[model samples]
Target: MRARDVRAILFCAVTTLILLIGSYVLLQSALISLALAAGWLAWLLTRPRMQRVIRRLRGEPDWNGYFRND
Candidate 1:
């Protein structure tokens, strides 16, 4: 709906596309290409910035706020 959301989606699409094509070209295996793309995405999502963005998108409380409350 939002521009930021659209940009994020586009980024993910492009990243996955590049990874899939690159891995497939290099290794010539569909399954391995998919696996590598998934692995790459999983790694990216685990990053602190991505985690915070995901939490915020889910309407969850921030780590700083939670810590200050305790």
Candidate 2:
């Protein structure tokens, strides 16, 4: 398998393991699982690198663009 594919599989396995363990050891309620999933998603969304890549892709004007606009 390719390196990227291997990495992806490993990541997925680890994530699944973590979620399973958390659910089993902490609380078995559906609400708790849903909350954990939502919290994980929110943490991923607020990451700094993700924000930078998203802003660049959206073509938001930066410092250089601001100076040119003046």
Candidate 3:
């Protein structure tokens, strides 16, 4: 895996952990934690860099013929 992909995964993991702690330990709610985590994941998925990492992890080729216009 590329450094960027590793970094992205780490970032996601850390952010989710913090959010979970804040939601349950601090705020005392599991529902809010779930919503916040889902929101964060949705936002992350919208990022182009994250999308590239996800595609790479899925073993998709970077230079597929679908990218070219006929």
RMSD of each: 5.3, 8.7, 5.2
Winner by TM-score: 3
Q: Candidate 2, after superposition: displacement of residue 18 in Å?
A: 2.8
For candidate 1, write residues 19-69 as lDDT tens digits. 999999999999999999999899887876566667767887775753242
C-alpha lDDT of residue 17 in model 2: 59
| Alpha-carbon deviation at 47 in model 3, angstroms | 1.0
Model 3 over residues 14-62: C-alpha lDDT tens digits?
A: 9988888888887788998888889988998889878877888999877
C-alpha local distance difference test of each model: 0.77, 0.58, 0.82
Could you tell which candidate, 1 or 3, scores higher by lDDT?
A: 3
lDDT of 2 at 70: 29
Candidate ordering by lDDT (highest first): 3, 1, 2
lDDT of 3 at 22: 84
Q: Candidate 1: where are CA atoms >4 Å away?
A: 1-9, 63-70
Cα lDDT of model 2 by residue, 1-70, tens digit: 2354355446545775588568857886767776776776567547654454445557764544421322
Q: Give residue 11's lDDT in candidate 2 (0 to 100).
A: 57
Model 3 lDDT, full chain set? 0.82
Better of 2 and 3 by TM-score: 3
TM-score of model 1 vs. true structure: 0.67
